[model samples]
Target: MPPDPADDREAGTVFLPKFDDRGLLTAIAVDAKNSEILMVAFMNEDALAATRASGAAHFWSRSRQSLWKKGETSGNILRVREILVDCDQDALILRCDPAGPACHTGARSCFYRRLEGEALVRVKT
Candidate 1:
């Protein structure tokens, strides 16, 4: 069943909720001027807890099945400016202040590749 809007909004405002497997978080990394989705990260229970406790961005690595802080090892830190949970409490919207490139390859974002016709070409690389 879908959760009540008020209830979920309250929950997100008061109690930071966890995301399920099917959940998808839209990480909108605006130029800090114009809002845009630079990259996205999925959060499990641990990731949510860690991010809530700390201002840092944490995500559950789907492949590794482990918790990973955005800039745990790298100096490129991703700070959470604001967080929004969907009405159904299924997905998330994170507005962040990226200190450095969000992409592991040191690009401005993870979505540097554009859809060229039908091929998935590396536009930035």
Candidate 2:
């Protein structure tokens, strides 16, 4: 699919859609070649631009209000292979070559949380 049209490039950064300053990124996902969801992230247009320019997983940290390149400090950077947008242009599928574990805790994936009964269970064992 074609890259997002609103995805403008300037000053070495990317810009994505922000609806009425909602600050909620509506499009994003990470996947491997085999279609496993390696990770997911919310992207501001800037994050999308940075990701496109750098070929790394860059995300807009809503809590931190900054750009965070995945595995930047942890040495787990994802080499983005391609960016896919779903129909309606509101969602994204990122194809990447993960350098190492995707999760910050050193797990292969971020889906470490599981459901046990009604409580959220962390899979550490």
What ranges in model 2 sit over 4 Å off? 1-28, 120-125
Error of 2 at 87 (Å): 1.2
Model 2, span 16-116: residue lDDT tens: 34432645455444556676676777887778889889888788887898989998898998888888765434467788888888888787778778998
Worst 10 residues of 2 by lDDT: 9-18
Q: In lDDT terms, which candidate is top?
A: 2
Clashes of each: 0, 4
Candidate 1 total steric clashes: 0
Q: In candidate 2, which residue pairs get closer than 3 Å at backbone N, Cα or C atoms, i.e. clash?
A: 14-45, 14-49, 15-45, 16-45
Predicted model with the maximum TM-score = 1
lDDT value, candidate 1, whole model: 0.70
